[model samples]
Target: MPKAYFEPEYLNALVEVFHEAKRILERRGITHPVAVDAVARRILSLAQEGVPPWQILGEVLPPMTPEAAGLPEVASTNDIVVSGPAPDTER
Candidate 1:
């Protein structure tokens, strides 16, 4: 899908809010890339609707968690299993 565009003034504020939200999520241990990207997209959407940066920074970001950020609990490498044909022991 095409990326959303923003006015220069809104773009600047969106960038600032995006970074601040990233920092907040990191501090809260929501460091998953999906969560961070979701927050950034949300910030831009809200800004496009004319929400101010201060409100986005102060109100919109504080309550976010991994679930709130819309990311499912990620499985660790050890939790993932690859299925394949069994080895040929008779060879």
Candidate 2:
């Protein structure tokens, strides 16, 4: 049997709302997919960060963006790692 076509539960939850939101925005000439998705992604990120659903919706609705909630900043590390040469073995 083929694997199911259904999206993972987590993905579906995130996409469904955004899909609806994007369509509404597009119909209103908000064709900038990047900005639309940016907003959706911000909302979803806030949800994943444990923001209360109501609070997230309220904050995202108007006069606010994800940055307004003062979410904890994520620290980033350099992608490249440094390594020293292998040590020589004594006979």
Pairs that collide in candidate 1 are none
TM-score, cand. 2 vs. native: 0.40
TM-score, structure 1 vs. true: 0.54
Best by TM-score: 1
lDDT (C-alpha) at residue 27 in model 1: 74
- In Å, residue 51's CA in model 2 sits off its true spot by 4.2
Tens-digit lDDT track of model 2 for 1-91: 3222233654565555566666656654677868787878777776667664445544554433435555666557658766998677977
Clashing pairs in 2: none
TM-score against truth, every candidate = 0.54, 0.40
Indicate the worst ten consecutive residues by lDDT in candidate 2: 1-10
- What lDDT, from 0 to 1, does candidate 1 have? 0.72
Considering summed lDDT, which 10 consecutive residues are worst modelled in model 1? Answer: 1-10
